[model samples]
Target: MNVHLGKTPVGLDGIAAAETVLSHVDGQQGELIIAGARVADLAAASGFEGVTARLWSAATTRSISEAEVRASLGLARQRAFARLPELLAATSGLTIVDGFRAGIAALRPEAGLDDEAAIVGACPVIAGALVQRARGSEPVAPDPDTSHAADTLRMVRGDTPDRGEVAALDTYLVTVSDHGMNASTFAARVVASTQADLFAAITAGYCALTGPLHGGAPEPVLEMLNAIGTRDNIRPWVDAALARGERLMGFGHRIYRVRDPRADVLKSAIERLAGGGADLPFASEVEAYIRTALRQKNPDRVLDTNVEFFTAILLDALRIPRQAFTPIFAVARAAGWTAHAREQQRTGRLIRPSSAYIGPRP
Candidate 1:
């Protein structure tokens, strides 16, 4: 029964595993479209709540209101807060994302809150709690009245974030909200295709995002910058790292043949936070130096900046620690995961792909 398709795709690259109207990534042109609009345009036009609502409505093929989603998430956060102590205890020895995994796994949907609302709403609560716990600080209560981005920073920093800082965070959350069929989104859809509950699918997505090749690269990007230590060390650092055959953490993308568009979106967001938050001048100087060095090294190839590069700087300026980078990514990407999950359940089949075996013939 040899039923394998054409040459099996390595890592499923170039595979159209699912069709989605939710988002599209045009790697050649470096464009991202979410909910029928360019990501840059959408991210610019809306906050996290608005972007999330748009994605949800597109995926479910219904008109879900942003205010309704926001209110539901607020209610869910209050409920999610009840489990923080237990989550903190259970996840004491784990990384922030691991704590999030435990917390998400523990979620049980209740009356008046659908699973999508429950997971998305509770994500910031869980992420913020883990961040606070990691810092040996008590988690602040969520302000359902405040926007999700502001409340998230509040819980982690134990202080109310100013308007600019809140806006920066909201921009970031919206920028990375959904990214076509990345590994994590695919994982979410795979689980959902199996008819698993939304929580189960989202948990799968969260687990996938913890991998270094995915959401885990931002902190390492910061580590690289810290290693360089100064603007003067930029070229020498690039040469040394390249000579040693180390991949620059945030320079290239597997999908994008050009500069990642999300890079620009986040870079602008960081710049806007320049009055107080992320050091835009230093980061720009470093980026320019590194980009030049990479282009000089690989003239025939296009190795340009990606999202993680500025993500590190932006989050660092916000006073978020290194460990929480991936967790916060999960917090932001939950919107995409839930939307993809619901879409799969509504429109796709159980994601069972066949494998091509090339072992010694029996």
Candidate 2:
């Protein structure tokens, strides 16, 4: 017996494509819950590795441990470093995002390191390599003794990061761990539904992420702010952009009618970082002015602040170049993609949605 609901709204809006215990995004109330905890509390409390374990536990039958996840990831990082020279040689001269994707695509199943650990652990290393390449510096090797987020910062900067810097990046990673069945997550599920390997599903998600509508917003956030230059230029530039019908990048989200909950989580992370300089304060003012201007321009439409706005600021505060924003995002989001793939595979059902035929009368 086959069942047909027969309602395929454009973009699958208001659709529950899959059953997931991993994370839920309540756009109306602006709430994000991950693995039975609210996103804010989870990010504040758990390290990214712990969050990865939690998400994995929710999807898999086994009770995965934080220590196990951490240990596996540490070894995976070492292996990734071992493979780096070869990967870079094969992928020379590609842009940061492209090179990062190429490197991940080159991953083959290994004897001891599972694809799960390989995908998650390789993200920071790959993204950091791109940053180093852009700066004309040699890629820094991974340090297994340090925590994942700390090592990520260390690699990006080629220097050991202190506790606070590590904490900020961890919070950023934990906050973006999952958000319902997003485009990338859905794409991952589709790939996994066919019983594909973890690497394939994650690579599918990564491909979806590279799309301009999704992963492209955050880096451009810094670019827009740089173009605005100073606090004084915020209002005028916003007004002109709105007049010229240009979007204020990072301000809007397709899913969230209210402000993105991740933005608040990240904005708070920014407050905890060391540099309380003019940038955050100025960005705060810009955020306020843009919110008001956007509201005034279209009173009915709610295009509230999204994660990308604060993400750009937070990454900038950590001194990461704009070019590596999406790659870093892929690193964090790989946690979610892994779990979603597992969850989809458990159902043993393929994602086969039908399109309504609207052309050519018989």
| lDDT (CA) per prediction | 0.87, 0.86
Counted clashes in each candidate structure: 0, 0
Instruction: Note each model's CA RMSD in angstroms.
Output: 2.1, 3.1
Candidate 2 stretches greater than 4 Å from native: 1-7, 276-278
Q: Write the per-residue lDDT of candidate 2 for residues 1-362, one digit (tens) a residue.
A: 34446666888888788888999888889999999999989987899999999998999867989999999888888888888887676668888888887888877776697678888988888888878988999889998877889889888889877788889999999998888888899999999999988888888899899998988888788888889999889888999999999999888788898999999899998998856342788888889999999999999999999998998888888877778888888889999999989889986598898777655665
Query: Over all chains combined, what TM-score does candidate 2 have?
Result: 0.95
Best by lDDT: 1
Positional deviation of 107 in candidate 2, in angstroms?
A: 1.0
TM-score list, all predictions: 0.96, 0.95
lDDT of 2 at 92: 84
- Give the true-structure RMSD of model 1: 2.1
- Tell me the tens digit of each residue's lDDT in model 1 across 29-146: 9999999888888778899999989989998889999998889888888878876776456676887878888888888776888888889888888888887777777787898888
